[model samples]
Target: MSRKPSTSHFLLLLIIIITVAVSAARTSAQSTSLCPSSSVNPEFCPINCFRPDPVCGADNVTYTCGCDDALCAGVRVVKLGPCDA
Candidate 1:
């Protein structure tokens, strides 16, 4: 005779699946949130004008021309100013 699964067992499995899904989503978000320096591609970047609006990048480097330069450098801005000395 085949044994039916218990309600508690099903609930536990469901909880595990939900937890795994949430964890995976968070991991994906975190990984995508930061652009590594190795991915820097400045080919399409706008010309670096004389503008000097410094923005701090997640890599602790300062992008003196704001987010445009930061994105071109494959870096995520951490703040809107130069990194602390």
Candidate 2:
């Protein structure tokens, strides 16, 4: 004879599956790090300066900017979508 799962057993299994799925989704949605260009001038660096075309991954949301050298400045962040571009 075969036994069926009790309601509590089914609930527990569902909770476990949901927890694992949520964890996986969170991991996959993490943002990537960005580095500024190596030739940016600090004196002219705008507080909100960012590149028009940024290289981004799936979870790009925030950005950080800094000058690396003396001629080029850049903003780094995961690529935001068109709305944020």
Candidate 3:
């Protein structure tokens, strides 16, 4: 005669699968970090806005305003226009 699997055995297997899935998810989530070019001293950084003004930085990255280029990006302002221009 063939033996049937017990309910407790099935429950244990389901718990193990759930635990492994959650552990994998947390590991992946923690692997992502802030970009290196972002502001190191964010306490004095300017608030971002949607104004039409834009400025280019010495690093060639276009920022939304002068404060972003100088304070947030910690780079000198290269020009008063977008870097793509």
**What C-alpha lDDT do the candidate models reach, one value each?**
0.79, 0.48, 0.68
**How would the candidate models be sorted by TM-score, starting from the highest?**
1, 3, 2
Q: Which candidate is the best by lDDT?
A: 1
TM-score of 1: 0.47
Q: Which ten residues in a row have the lowest lDDT in candidate 2?
A: 63-72
Model 1: how far is 83 from its true place, Å?
0.7
What does candidate 3's lDDT look like per residue over 10-45, in tens digits?
Answer: 999999999999999999877643222445367865
lDDT (Cα, 0-100) at 83 in candidate 2: 20
List the lowest-lDDT window of 10 residues for candidate 1. Answer: 32-41
By lDDT, is 1 or 2 better? 1
What pairs collide in candidate 1? none
User: Which portions of model 2 miss their true places by more than 4 Å?
Assistant: 31-85
TM-score for each model: 0.47, 0.42, 0.42
